[model samples]
Target chain A: MNFFLGIKIFFRSLFLQSVWNYERMQNVGFVFSLIPFINHLYKDKTVRAQKIKTHFGFFNTHPYLANLLLGIVMRLEEKCLKNEVSQEEVLRTKTMLAGPIAAIGDRFIWSTWRVVCSFIGVAYYLCSGKEGVWYQANIFVGILLFLLIYNLLGHLPLRILSIYWGYKYTNNVVDKISKFALQSYIVKIRNVGIIILLFASFIYSISLISDLKIVLLFWLNILLSLLLSKKIAEVGIFYILFLLNIIILTVTNL
Target chain B: MKLSLWFLFISTIAGLFHLDVMVFGQFMFSRPIVVAPIIGILSGLPEVGLIVGIITELLYVSIIPVGIKIPPDSTTVAVLTVVCSERLIDIPVALFFAIIFGFLYKYIDIAQRSFNSLLLGWVDTAKAELVEQRVNLLIIYALFITYLKTVLFYLIVLPILSFFIKQVFCCWIKNLWVHMDLYNLIYILPAIGIGIGLAHFVEE
Candidate 1:
């Protein structure tokens, strides 16, 4: 692929879900992303049309990791055009890799990395043991830290690098990802998140400790959340707490 | 700045950041942690945004947007919570209403995706030359629709809801809240979020 065409497709991948639909989620976005590449590779209108149609099946993956798949597909298409690889292999690669890539992206990005970054930010905000003090510059830094670390370190570079790795490694990209041992990193990150969260809670508890009942109440709610998250939505838990608040208000005329 | 100006500005910001949720790169921009504080700072109320953003983040920490499951729109809740609090609404009450609206917004999200399905047939049948332009058109339509829906909702609903909550609920609950010491109740929200997040770490 021409370097400029690769750059164009990378930019287009940012809009990978601009028109996601239930029937073929991300298919439109995929077609839109690959159009520049198709135009670059195939001159004949008929072949370009056939190539476009080839990718028009159900396609959904975690958006960030989808860049890797895009790279691999582009590489596959290049080989297919030269009759080095069969069209079926190109299509199969897209379908086969979609599930695993989505799983990795969802776990790493959504479940692990996002949680870690959010807690790091939240913990910083509460670290000073101040409540309702919004003017503190530390809190601003805290939020900014989350955004900066998450994007600069996690999302932005990963999107760009995944494309490079996927293209360079081709079908071996998954094997490369495995060698990186993302699950172990996820475990370490989750552990750090848990520590930061606990420490932040401890800091907050110090400020609220004057009211022993309130501290106990706070712990109770935490216990409730831990127990109820699977069974109830956050909205339901929120209202339930409100209902409990009504009872507490009625029972104790504080 | 006028309240109308604030509404328009915030609506625009909300729409832009919300694009991160699904319409574009999952860049974490739409996460409550990122948008809430910025939106909060923009509205001249940084504390409200930070606290709401933190609590909201912890609250929904366990809810992952994996696969077919459509979890509650925590980003919407964060944006609405900060926006609602900016109008001098009580943080807890503001959260209540925002959660309701956020719940409703999830349905709107599902509906928008469903509507996008309408163009699938055309995409399948279009000629090659037409396919590129048509896909481009569809993307613009999808983005425009999402942005417009959020902007219109904020423009119309925020004033009425803020007024009613300020006039009606605040009047009744202010003294009661002070007496019961539930003002500290907002603190517990983070605990719940923290707990849920802990569960995710343990289980996931």
Candidate 2:
């Protein structure tokens, strides 16, 4: 691949979720990102259009890791053009790779990395002290810190490299991804996230320390959250607690 | 007049954030940690935004939008909550309305995704010429329509919800502030979020 075409595919891959329909789920987006590659591979309009038609099948995967699939598929399409690989093999690779990549990407990026980074950001904001004149400046900095940590450490490298890695390894990129032992890292990050969450929650809950009743209620909230978590999501617990707080405060007349 | 203009501004920004969640890269930019604070800072309620943002973020942090399953529209909740909070209505009541809007917004996404399936038909049967151009156009049109749907959702829903919450709040909680410790309630809301957040990491 030329530098310009790689750059084209990289940028175009960012729009991989642009038309995420429930029916086929990112098939159009996958085809869209590969347009340049198709045009480059097939010289005739009929052939190019036929190649496009072949790729319009169902395609879905985690957005960030999609370039890996795109890169692999691009390579496969090229190989198919050369008659070294069958079209079924190329299509099968897409369907086969998508589910595993999506699982890894979802667990790593969505479940672990994003959670850990934002937990740190929220911690920073709590430590910055929310009661003073500098709170706005503090929030601004906290937000900048989050956006920086996430994009710089995690997002940028993944996005810029996913396609190249996929193209280079083709079907074997899973071996490359597995060699990282991301499961261990995901566990470690989640453990660290727990620490950050506890410490930050402690910091944010400090104001209630002076009010004995509120402190008890705060601890009780934590216990109840733990107990009921499996039964309902945090959001549901949030609503129930919020309504209860409002109701108790008003009914008891504080 | 100034407040009206700010509402317009906030709603427009909210629509863009929704686009980030749906169409654009699912960058953490669309996360409540970012969206709520931006709306809050712009509305001169930075602290409320920060607190609400934390709570909303934690509430949503565990959700994975895997496969075709649609997560609740937490971004919409954060955006509308921050926009309607404190200035137009009380935070707690605004939150209730915002959560309702959040659920309602999912219907919009469901509808948009279904419509996108129709657009899928266009690409499935495109002529031999300029199929790439047709796909590009369809993607752009889908994005534009999603943005418009979200913006219209904000424009139409924000006012009605705010009004409804204001009336209910005034009748119930507004005059009851003599017995209310609003800050306590606000502080505990995040405690619940943190508790739930803890549950997320600690389990399994």
DockQ of each: 0.66, 0.69
Please give, for residues A1-254, the per-residue lDDT of candidate 1 as tens digits.
66787778878888888887888889988888898988888898878877877787889999888889999998998899899999999989999999999999999998889888888888887766545443344656886788899889899888888778778888999998999988889899999898988888887877777777778877888788778877887667778876686567456764
- Candidate 2, CAPRI quality class derived from DockQ: medium
Q: Give the runs in model 2 whose Cα sits over 4 Å from its true position.
A: A129-137, A247-254, B1-4, B87-89
lDDT at A66 for candidate 2? 91
Task: Please provide TM-scores, in order, for all candidate models, with all chains considered together.
Answer: 0.94, 0.95
Best by lDDT: 1
Estimate the TM-score for candidate 2: 0.95
Question: Candidate 2 on B67-117: residue-level lDDT in tens?
Answer: 998888989989888877775226666776688778889888888888888
Q: Which ten residues in a row have the lowest lDDT in candidate 1 chain A?
A: A130-139
lDDT of candidate 1 over B1-204, digit per residue (tens): 598897888888888988878777777778888888888888788878878888888878778877766787888888878877744327788888888887788888888889888878886798867777777888888778888988887788777767766776678878777677667777666777887888789766
- Scanning candidate 2 chain B in windows of ten residues, the lowest lDDT window is B175-184
Put down candidate 2 lDDT per residue, A161-242, tens digits, no spaces.
8888888899999988999989898999999998987876666556456676676777778778877888986667878887
List where candidate 1 sits over 4 angstroms from the true fold: A132-139, B86-89
Q: Per-prediction count of colliding residue pairs? A: 1, 0
lDDT of each: 0.81, 0.80
